[model samples]
Target chain A: MFRHNTLRYAVLVLLASAALFQAFTAEYFGLEILTEILILAMLVLALDIVAGFGGMVSLCHGALMGVGAYAYALLSTTAGIAPPVAMVGAVALTGAIAWAIGAICSRSHGIYFIMATLAFGQMAYSYVFEAPIFGGDDGLGGIARLDLSFVGIDLNDSRSFALFCLVVLGAIYGVSVLILRSGLGRSLTGVMHNEQRMRALGLTVWRVKADVFGLSGMIAGLAGVLAAQHIMYISPGLLSWTVSGEALVVVILGGLGTLVGPLVGAAAFVVLKHELSAVTTYWHLVVGVILIAVVMSRANGIFGWIEARWGDRIERRLSDTTRKPEAKEVLGDA
Target chain B: MLETRNLDKSFGAVHVTRNVSLKLERGERRIILGPNGAGKTTLFNQLVGELTPDSGSVHLAGEDVTALPVAKRARRGLSRSYQKNTLFDGLTVEENLGLATAVHTGNATQLWSDSLAKPEVREIVNEVAEQVNLMPYIHAKVSEISYGVRRQLEVGVALATRPLVLLMDEPTSGVGPEMSKGFHDLLNNLPRDLTMLIIEHDMDLAFDVADTITVLNYGEVVFDGLPEAARGSKLLKDIYLGNWEDA
Candidate 1:
């Protein structure tokens, strides 16, 4: 229902409102970093697709991001493909891998699924680490920037690319929002509560789980493609389980499935990492402490708590009429 | 019509079911009465495809379903409720019943469809909930309700499956006497085509409702007959009073 998803749509509107600040003279130097934060938000949103909505505790989402990054890096550079083609290719590659992993790993739930996804991620990491053509441990360098062919914009310039990344993030968020607000998302909520009941309901719980993972992976992969372009390089470490762990941490910190929770979490992570690492040798310690505090103090998450405060007001509105683009702002169940 | 033939199960040296065989014709009410460790639960598990019998087979409506998984068996008109309520703690009563509705129709894969949008699904759930008389507290959470309500939730879960053979494990193990009638009424009104094998300890209810009674003493049938034949034989009281009662 559009009513349930009002907050998500509002967050989208708020994020889009960032374009208004682009003209501000003082914001020029900070554009690239903020753009990176937005992309990170996209990644966190993708992670939430599985962990929060589907109840899959995946630690391999980062590796899925790696798949996208690799696809972009290979197609855009080595394969001499255009950026648009590379982007589509990246999504296809990552989404396929996500589906495969989801199908196999979804057979096991709770901690077992966690370990299975981790195992697959580690396998991807190892493949990237040892493959000679991929530059091995040194990583694949000399990755070219996106060439629009007709837009006539030089992507090497920081601000133009930052805007591009932000736009892409917005699109990805929209896609994720659409999927989560659909009938499919409701079944995912059911899975989170009780799988047995779901089976009795005559649901093929595995397929729904696989589909959830694939959706999240596609979004994560899209973010990864953008990230590789933004950084102009691809590394084997992109597929590391630690990166997946970080994504999981972001979802938790932001609050699981709370629409804008990922954005807040990404901002917290990016800002804290950039500012703290510049100042202290033990930056992770501070981030770790913050994480502990967030986890301990807020089970519903930052945005979740916000929703809980005024959820009654949102629930009062009826949203039986969903599935129309005109009602995107309605978010009741969208 | 459900039947298990020569079903044998064991846990290492301890045999849980030794050549146990039973059958329930369509519309028949069969109660299984046994001592504490007489493999009643084991038999239910085997029938529901949660446990594999070491030998022999199970048939539902004349179709061999010995190797089917639990959910698969459920799909083929076979449903069983846990002695312990397996309801999800996080969901409200309506949602749980809604899930049961989904199970009944077998559409567990619709991930995110807004429940309010599905008129057909809502109608089915409302009908079943009405039948079970759980409409009053449909929106209540499982944890917020009483033991009787919890049991009904479990039963509702099985009923949602709309099975041909309903297997209930200790349908009234911890229920108050007043709550028992609700269950009795619910069961009494069930379609005659839906056969049920109930495991229970209450002798009064067993005699009151069961058309056929199977008594297990030590992982084996001590008495298998009609309730009158079971009650007339000394073995009926012997299961409760030990060897001295039979003497």
Candidate 2:
């Protein structure tokens, strides 16, 4: 059921074309916005793994993202390390943090789990919020990007940097696809269906969920590492529960349980906020209304609706041509 | 292979199980029959470790298992079926049954990142699905199936665990007469070494399958003997039919 389709290809193409536009015609400002969209797409995809697929709707992802960001900042500054090493270290540390939170929170499933993760995430935020050594509320601002001299390219250039983010996004998307198609993905879906049966089968259901939830946090960490370097700034606001809620809202806005839903949601979210804020002070009201409309329609998501109304007919014809031999049984069964 | 002594449970003064005690030998099939509110389900829940007993002991195969949780109880060769069909609705039959096989094998590797496409899991799932007459419905999602079929699927799930003891409550609650007969034959032929404890409202099915009958009335045993002896006991009928005025 999960494979490369027109939607995936189209979204990838759309991302590529936008990157090309920034690389050639647009100024550094346009390139910066494009980079934010691309990286946020990665973070939203990570959020989707636990919330959309595994049925663990967490609101602490932004705080976990902070864990990654801080990991990169501290490792690079304290050890005078390169960015690549810092990114890896950050993701590993964040993965561990996510696993701890997941282990504790997965015990309490449903809405309580969401609230529990939210509380834990807030705890992380407040730790950074109050810790004087980590720059307190101002964040660790003096961190540096990886000095990638071996590649014979200056990452200081916004054009080159955008390319780095693009490549990272492509790699994460590929890995996400692989994970979603594996046996683990099937079991995670099974957990959502019946944890009791999963437990009865002698599965360490909690550990599995906690691990995957940690994996999602690691991916989000990757995005956070990229964002921290690009922005050259970090603050307590980044780890706020509202930011996590917004990410969730973006996921819901794009679509739930769809691979590309969160990406579209994030992009659409940033773009709408950018364009609408230019027109009026109350942009959120308008975005909220659109979000409400999309959810109420139960249209699967933006592309989900597009696929339902338009994509189905196309698929139906494709199946009809390829499965002529099974047509009798297929029609008879229906 | 299983026994409980002086089991007592209370929900704010309503004593669910009061000093309930019973024992069974390996290969013995005991059916617990009673009317509604007889605490049959509650007692089953306690024995299955879903509910804790305030003052009793649960032993399995001569080991004290009173402190074990539900998952451990299941792993210790205790499997149960609900009065209602408890199928994992979002999963396909093969996937659910595959999990059941994994349970009995005691494979606790449930990390979501691991693959379930191994040939071992596939082979075991097919075998159990075949055993429960669910081969034709292997690919079907449980939610899309009928209750009668779901009941069979639940049985397939239980059988996959390879339990030393099987506790089934109302296995034929909503089944058709024809399918009920099929399930009866299937239950009757289960491995003799599997200690069976059942609760059924259907008297004919009970007499046809059970080696011995245990009638429970108001959380107390009224009879425990052979099927012929149980059928001849007026007290058993009176308990089952809820005629408690004389008692």
Candidate 3:
């Protein structure tokens, strides 16, 4: 287990260093893309908590992030609240909304659950699109980044803001790792594996689902806050079902349950979208084909492929125990 | 410690569990014997709160738990093993046991630390692993284990919950005679104070482990008495062995 964790953290450290390098040396557009990747990575990480572990494929996560963005935008712009304070309020509001959604959706499973969340996402999108208070279809803007000049940091600068986003993303990633290794994570795994057994063993399965959903929402909301600040805009588009679909695609493209893989996925997705769009108007088609290829080539996604190929080799070197016999036994069973 | 009153269930026109009423005292080990489609598992489901009775009440430790959900009833010290293997196939055996022990000990809510690191949970996991004869396979994934070992794990998971009343559905359903014999020993070695209601097709195991036996046929209790009395019942022989003398 220690060896496994060491390999995971080693990869994380390498990614963090690369991100830090980009934050320090990248141009304005490059920093913008890096920040975008970080924000979406956070959102995907949150989605993994429910879809990957809790076994609930939510289609309303993009809407949940939009709710956070709007909450922050409105609280700061209309209510005249501080940006940091607004962020807290936004996350809390999103978490509560997500908890309610989870409680209701937990009653259904599989396709029904997906349809239910899609309905909620549509409702949120429609409300944001038509509501006059949210500037109608025009969207809300002029949102300012958190003022941290007092601490010898200037978030208004693109470099510092990108670095700040990276730090927050890193912290959230750390928390996600901690959560996946905790007792609650074990319960979620149990729930995911066999809901009947979990209930038989006395676990309140719905409660575990709802709790993880709420926590996931809070993380997604944090991502929303960063997105709004990064782009200085909030629109109904952010809450659209397509955004949810894209996030889900990125999740699968990276690897569903492997936390670090989502980060890699988010980067791959953003880069592909940007690079492909520049080449052709049929960028969506190209992206679709690529995703299909990825899924077909590796059902467990890119990270899973990597883990399958080299993860054991690294672990074998790190640990003294010979797992060859057991591995062979597993293969025979399969 | 577990009792059911007038439990009735029907799927469409077929009555699965007829007005089945039973009473088991604390520390009582009762064996439920039945043939195919006899509603043994249906009765176990109602008792565990998985299936609500069409019209009846279930009492656990003197409280009416008919309205309680499955998990809530389980939290109140009621647990059961599935007739089929219902294990976490992707997790190691120790994780399965650790999860059950954590839930039982109210440590499932811990979100910051490893549950198996807790001395109390580890102690119970080790103890239950020993009890179920699963010590050797504790580190093995459930998917990679042998069928007989998986059967043992089914009971091991139930025992890990430290249940006040355990309802096991066909614990030895698919095992060979040799493994079944070992299973019989395992059940015999369990704590005398732990109440168990086991559904069994193995007559020898039923007669061996049961202090009392309740025979079910066509969803109704045909006889409820001592194992010796149940063994001698002509009605049970007719329903189960089917008039072997005439044959």
- Most accurate candidate by TM-score: 3
Most accurate candidate by DockQ: 3
Q: Candidate 1, residue B138: CA error in Å? A: 2.1
Q: lDDT tens digits, residues B111-209, model 2? A: 333344666667778887877888777777776667788898888888888889888888888888988998888888788889999998888889999
lDDT of 3 by residue, B1-247 (tens): 9999999999999999999999999999999997788899999989988898899899999999999999999999999998899999988889989999999988786878978789999999999999999887777888788888899999999999999999999999899899999998999999999999999999999999999999888899988999989887888888887652342
The TM-score ranking, best first, is: 3, 2, 1
Candidate 3 docking: what grade?
medium
lDDT of 1 by residue, B1-247 (tens): 8987999999999998988888889999999998888899988888877789999899999999998877777788888888887787766667676665665554444544554347766787777677777776666666667778778778877786677888888877799887786677777787777798999887777888789999886678767889989877776676777673444
What's the distance in Å from true for residue B47, model 2?
1.8
Candidate 2 lDDT, A163-229, residue by residue in tens: 8888888888778776765666666776777787666554667877887788899998888898888
Model 1 residue A173 lDDT score = 69
Q: After superposing candidate 2, which stretches have Cα over 4 Å from the reference?
A: A1-27, A178-184, A310-314, A324-334, B103-115
Order of the predicted models by lDDT, top scorer first = 3, 2, 1
Worst 10 residues of 2 chain A by lDDT: A325-334
